[model samples]
Target: MPQTSQGSQAGEGADPAPAGRPPEHPPRWSWWLVGIVIPLVGIAVTVLTVPSQSPNRPPAPPASSSPATTRPPASPPPLPVGLFRLTNADSLMCLSPPPGNSTPAAGLVQGDCDARPEQFWRLRREETGTGVVYSVRNQHTGLCLSVDAAHKENDVTVTQYLCGDENGLFPDQFWSFRYDTLRHAWRLVSRNSGKCVALPAGSGDGEQALQEDCDGGTWTLWRT
Candidate 1:
């Protein structure tokens, strides 16, 4: 009714602010959550994602090696030492190298068991790579028993000569002993001839020792 003011009518449309209050903005607790709590949560996540540190350890040892192998040495033959007599099983005579003939190429013989030094032979065992063999040396004549060179037949002559050495090892000079356990005797076999030293049937004393076939019974067997 009276003169109404336009400015007062415009202010009347809006609500009035409360008296004695500060201007509205974000909450203090929200600023604390953004600056401190949220940053601490991010740091915990980063620490969980990162790989962990490991302690120092020693390296493993190398694999073990195998032990070395050792081979056994060759053994010696079972023959006697010193001088001995070879008594023929068939004739009961002693083998000798031509009594009083100490020279080479003297034929061997069998005679009465007079217990003479010439009848006694010394067996010298040689340890060769092939096998064990013996060189029959006369105690009196100092000669070694042998067979005629390269003769492989029966009744081949067995002789005595100078003992061969490593320089000239005559194969005939080497002899091998074959033992017959049942008869308790031995057979003297020649290396070159491969025959046994045998006595002929019904032969008497002073008969020549001959190389013969390894058969026809006990004529080849000898006893020491």
Candidate 2:
């Protein structure tokens, strides 16, 4: 219900602190050299290492857009829903919503393989107990992904919105990266319909699409 992001207040320009009158000089001592040199060294290191959080700098990488692909397909097919744990492992592959575009989500890429927040997901079974589902979350907005009822192929744009309605439910509303779990890698499956939803903007059409009994393409595979 809140905005995806908020602007921050930048530090305003300010005059440097004044150098007050010099106090009586201390008797020259060896320890004085150590104190002065050590402090100077420390200042230099801090200047060289500590980064300033001033807003004047370029934004810090839009807070890592997405997370890494998890799980391995090695023994995928027969595996139970929750056993497919996400990790820094690459035995996994993410499916782009079908049609054309390319480029993995930032968190699931080679660099971000851990349980980085953006890439975190949970596997779930439909409340009706008909099928399983996976969800990819971006904590920043507290939203998952929504579909443009018209998107039936690849290369479509994915927009951010609240995680609700059919978009937040299963069949077309899931992450399909693990093998044997039913949905394609990072694939979307519509919940109520038991239909495999395609993101024409993210990945491709699966080999086994069935006809839809509902308004949208019923190409869902889990139909009994």
Candidate 3:
């Protein structure tokens, strides 16, 4: 017997089936193709469109007029760089270490801070009266701290030397001030380990006072 053609077959006149066989349906590829393509497109779009959230950090604060809680201030200045009048126990001049590089050391002592060029002072930094500094200049020598080497604890000395070499400046010559006399007086201070700072002598500069009970005398009466 002749077979009948099915409408959904490949060819217009394609045969659907033989007498006892079921009609062949075209493989259902449209649904499968759509399912694969839709998921693939969706994944591609997600990859291209999403963004990251990772770049914004925080800030810092202004500086304070103080040392850290556990530590002390750094060091003394080169020498008295500002307007100062020396009072070496009624002696009118600011004292300096006696002559050295000669014989047995005279150790660090006070000489008259007079019109001698070696006694005149200028600041280490040009910024006037800044930090813990007061540049000591020699009036007669027209020179500043000329330490041949860096100064150390206790053995520090001031000299009437030229201020050219980097190591010429000693740390002991410069005076540091902490507010005193109800903030009306200024006292010279020193640091032991570059941390804690305190006055070295009593009001008379005898190396006894701890900046707390300085003698109310002219020797320690330093003005800005």
Candidate 4:
């Protein structure tokens, strides 16, 4: 009791720490949690601030182009050959050579429309100019309408002659038929004289056919 020093009395007043250990400090994980939690909160704030797109919007349409072009049709060609009856609009009389005189130099006259061989003609298109010229031959005589020796004179009687001369030297033999749109009839024009085939006024059976200025009258109008 006399020797129990002051050092022993001081140790008993304060508790002693455990062996091989340091004094406790605040945990370092709190700072690490603060760093991780700050980034997570920032990401959540960014996600909530942005706007969302609508799902019901329609898509855009494509561009357009121009239209195409077009054209028209052509006209029909004429017939090459055919059998026909030559008649006038006035009397409807058939053209024929005087009975029993179907030879060359015989004159064409108006007769009954009786389907006789003399009344039937074989019309063949001449391969010459414009394909409008034709050789009008008698079925019975095998001759064609001719202008005496290819004469170009007026009032010259039209007669029958042999066919097969395509030289055009005798344009008298070639005849051109033109459709008169106004008159609604056919006009027989001579290739040589350029005059029209006409049935003279006061003409009857056995009368010779002649040429005259085109008048588009029934006398100059013919039917095939």
Candidate 5:
């Protein structure tokens, strides 16, 4: 009978264990407090650690002031001054007035290549366009090649006249050059009459220069 009572006592202890599993106490207040306080502390820390802008700070410099901004260098001017000889392509002669004749009416003539001061011409740029106008000045007499009375007539003669003469400025003094690709030569065209400098038919030494319509003929071809 005592063994049966001890077995009943053990069964009763086992039943209390199942009742104990329901809950020993309600949820801890410390855990609830920790959950609420931890989030509040995190929000407070985030607010305190964030950076703020100051209204008194100066503005940054412009992008153009940066090292990447640079300007290109300027280009050089073209040189149009030089010494040359105006040679007739057909006659194979140089244009030179008689060295002693420095008068306004002294006509220019085709002469043998002597490389004299009378044949040495200084070309100076007068204007720029599709073609550039140059004043052909003689190194010997300091005269300029000009048309007779600035005439626009065909077969007119070319002469060496005083540069900037009191007779007044004339376009006849300005000569332009056109390149002849076919002949590989240049045509000396007068600015006033628009005529090409030419050697007369059967030209010889001391023959005067003539103005004719440009036809790319060997007589109209000139070289510097």
Candidate 6:
């Protein structure tokens, strides 16, 4: 039997999709490509946004650097205790009691440099408000060098006496050393008079040592 013309046209016009269902989706590979491309774009953006340190940049210094330490200078040694001969610079003589006189209150004088007990003096130290002073003690008579209180003149005679005061009330027995750089020696300065032990001009043997103005000259300088 030959089909009708209307039936043939209806059969040829059948629906490509089902009546109540959605159309077929795209290929799975296309979805995978979209997912990969989106993540790659996000990673590129993150890398560009963050900052990076330069390869040649120097490292930062410490927050608080410690300062360098320095050391103080050393102090000089103290003078030693011993018996010594005091020689006058001007007259070039040794200081001792008057020749043939070893008694107390005998004046000190310049004499020939010899190995006499009268010429040897034991230097004893005494700390005072002024400074470190010395008591010039005669080894022979066991007396201390002192200034004559009776003489108030510029040039006062220096004598030897007992080595004690009631309470250091008298400073005549205390003497300090003043350094003379030019002469390279020490000047014997009296603590009581603030004067210097010196020899007179054109001093000769047997000349007495007196307290005079501190001229800082060869006359006032003495060597130990």
The candidate scoring highest on lDDT is 1
Q: What is the alpha-carbon lDDT for the whole of candidate 1? A: 0.83
TM-score comparison, 2 vs 5, better candidate: 5
Candidate 2 accuracy as lDDT = 0.37
Provide the lDDT at 127 for model 2. Answer: 47
Each candidate's lDDT (Cα)?
0.83, 0.37, 0.42, 0.78, 0.80, 0.81
Put down candidate 6 lDDT per residue, 1-224, tens digits, no spaces: 97689867877866657678976899999999999999999999999998986789778887876777886544333443788888888778998998668787788999889988889888887877677888888888888888887353567888888787677525688888877655666788887778888889769899988888988568888888
The segments of candidate 2 whose C-alpha lies over 4 angstroms from its true place after superposition are: 1-111, 128-130, 146-150, 158-160, 165-171, 174-224
TM-score head-to-head 1 vs 3, winner: 1
Model 5 per-residue lDDT at 221: 88
Tens digits of lDDT, candidate 4, 1-224: 58888889878867788899987886899889999999999999998998876788677776656655555433333433678888887767888887768788777888878967888888877787556688888888988988777777778787888774564436688888877655556788888788887888657766678877777578898777
RMSD of each: 14.0, 38.1, 19.2, 14.1, 12.1, 11.2
The candidate, 2 or 3, that scores higher on TM-score is 3
- Candidates 1 and 5, the one with greater lDDT: 1
* Candidate topping TM-score: 1
Model 2, span 1-224: residue lDDT tens: 85544332233355546699667776779778888999899999999998877667665666666787787555434423332322211123222222221222211121223343433333444343544454544443344443344244542333333445654452334534323243432224445333343222222323212212222321222110
In model 5, state the lDDT of residue 91. 89
Which tens-of-lDDT digit does each residue in 1-224 have in candidate 5? 43667667777745455544565675789789999999999999998999876679678876785477566644333323677788888988999887667777698998898858788888878754646678888888888888888899888998988777586447788887787766666888898888988888668999989888988579998777
Residues 105-189 of candidate 1: C-alpha lDDT, one tens digit per residue: 8888888998678888898887767788888889999888887664788878888887887675577888899887667788998
Global Cα lDDT for candidate 6? 0.81
User: Candidate 1, clashing residue pairs?
Assistant: none
Which portions of model 6 miss their true places by more than 4 Å? 1-80, 150-152, 166-169
Q: Can you give the TM-score per candidate against the true fold?
A: 0.62, 0.29, 0.33, 0.60, 0.60, 0.61
